[model samples]
Target: MIIATGATGTLNGATVDHLLQRVPAARLGASVRDPARARHLADRGVRVRRGSYEDPVALRRSFADAEQVLLVSSSDIGADVVAQHRTAIDAAAAVGARRILYTSTCGAGFETPYPPLAIHAATEQHLAASGVAWTALRNGFYGDLGQLLGPWQETGTIAKPADGPFSWVDRRDAAEAAAAILAGDAAFDGPVDLVPSSPVTLADFAAAASELSGRHIERVVVDDEDWVAGEMANGTPEGAARFTLSMFQATRGGHFAHADPTLVQLLGREPRSIADQLADQNIG
Candidate 1:
């Protein structure tokens, strides 16, 4: 069975769809924080299990009858993810899972600026030592820039921390690649950089935004400290601001810019472009 965490989220939903199309419903397991949130998955014939990354007992129960498990990194801020992931991994190991797949940030190889990237890197180290066959989807930035919560892009400028290049991947594409890996039909057993084919700078992205939305969008380059403070001022929790700032700082450091060719090779098609993704999100 393929047990998928974060089944309520965008990436997990797409991953579950791909898995269900290839594997049978009985072979699919979905671990969601809320069973009610997974009604669609149940309707589509996936075995829905209510669980969270924080609860070890729930995780253990969720993986009881699983051959493979996918840990979509929790959306929690700060050290919570590390603890939550540890709980899940320990549970999976105890439940005798054959293999585990972790969704981590791209370039989490000790050089990424995102502090959580360090958490993922450390998790990878622990997974490696756990003696379980594992794979890391080093995912880059999400392509749904226009679908952010709160204000629409038209209300204000698209704010990103960096003026550097970015290789944004469609969440659907990442999920597809992940589905392929989980199927275990090939000899894949290491870190796979699930990035886009082309790396676009912040300026290029702003241009795309303007062209797509028919609005004159601008990119605001803010220092990490200033950005954190601004987020706090804008009613974000202090911890949330710090965490968001860390990711932006990482982007400025080129942590999300590297475009690995293997993504297209594995998908056997050109991954969707940022314009294509933005359009799909109904921005263009």
Candidate 2:
């Protein structure tokens, strides 16, 4: 049997949806924080269990009788995400899981300026020391560039801090690749980067938007402090604004510039490009 954490969320939910097509519902389990939200899955005959990284006993029980578990990383930005992951990893090991696949970031390392990158790195280290087989799904940066672009359709301008390139990837493609890995016969040990076929800078993204919408979208580079202040003025919390600003700092440091083909090889085709994603989303 296979169990997936965060099964009600977008990425893992998509993975579970794909898994249902390849595996029987009896062989599948969903570990969600709120089982009430996952009633649709249960209605389809999936086993739903309440699990939380904060509760080790519940997590252990959720993983019972499972051969493999997909540990989707938490979205809590202010919490001690490393400790939460450690609790889940220990619980999976205690349940005698054959393998644990963790969703990690592409530039998760000690030197990255992004705070979550360090948390992911620490979790990977803990997983290595655990007495269970592990695979780190190094997913690329999400392709929700519109959030940073700030109403580009009406403003006709994309403003951000001066940054470097990033290999943006759609969550849909990442979900499909993760489903393939989880349901495949072969084993993938250690870190597997799921990135796009190529990387694109912010200017390149603006150009793509301009071409897709047939509108002149100007790319404006602003100071980091000015960007943060602007975000706060727009009603974003101060902490959240600062955290979002760090991503550009990390990108300027060349953390997310590299492209990897692991996702392409897993999917048997090239991953979607930034231009295609923008065009599909109809972002001006």
Candidate 3:
């Protein structure tokens, strides 16, 4: 049986749905935070079990009678991600899962500049030490959703602190990749970066978006001092704005620019380009 965590989340839900088509409903289980909320999945014939990152018991119970478990990372901020992942990993191992697939962040090596990535990198290291067959999908940024500068995108101006480019992957593609890995078609024993074949700078992205939307979008770069000032002037909370700006600054340093060939090979075709993805969404 294939047991999947984070079944309620967008990407995870999509992954489970794809796998459900390939595997029978009896062979599929979803670990959700609330069984009541998973009525939709249950209606589709998935076995639903209650679980959460904060509750290891729930996870242990959820992973029971499962062969393969996909451990989707938690989205909690300010908490110890490593600790949360450890809880899920321990539970999966206890249930004797034959293999584990973890959704992780891209650029998981020690030299990565992004500090948030450290949590995932550490979790991957721990998973390796757990003596289980493991595969890690070190994912890139999601391209379907716009950033916090979303409102700015509508106004034909993107004000960000980043100075460089980012190569983002469509969440749909990431979900499909997860399904393929869970199907046991791709054989690997370690972590792999899930990113596109190419990247586009933030400026280029904004410009292309403007062209697609028939707007004259322009990049308004903000420095450290001005970033806070602009945030306040724009009615943003000081603390939240500072954190968001810092993430952009990291991106400017090529934090999200990692490129890999694995995505194309796994999908057996070229991953969607920025323009192609936007066009599909009718954003252009």
Q: Candidate 3 versus the native: TM-score?
A: 0.91
Cα miss at 250, model 3 (Å)? 2.3
Model 2, which residues run further than 4 Å from truth? none
- Give Cα-based local distance difference scores for all models: 0.79, 0.90, 0.81
Inter-residue clash pairs, candidate 2: none
Give the candidate order by descending TM-score: 2, 3, 1
* Clashing pairs counted in every model: 0, 0, 1
Candidate 1: residue pairs that collide: none
- lDDT per residue (tens digit) for residues 185-269 in model 2: 9899999889987877889888988998898999999899998899889999999888888899999999988888789988899
Q: Give me the overall lDDT of model 1.
A: 0.79
- Residue 172 miss distance in model 3 (angstroms): 0.8
- After the best TM-score superposition of candidate 3, give how far the Cα of residue 182 lies from its true spot, in angstroms: 0.6
Please say which candidate is ahead in lDDT: 1 or 2.
2
Task: Report model 2's TM-score to 2 decimal places.
Answer: 0.96
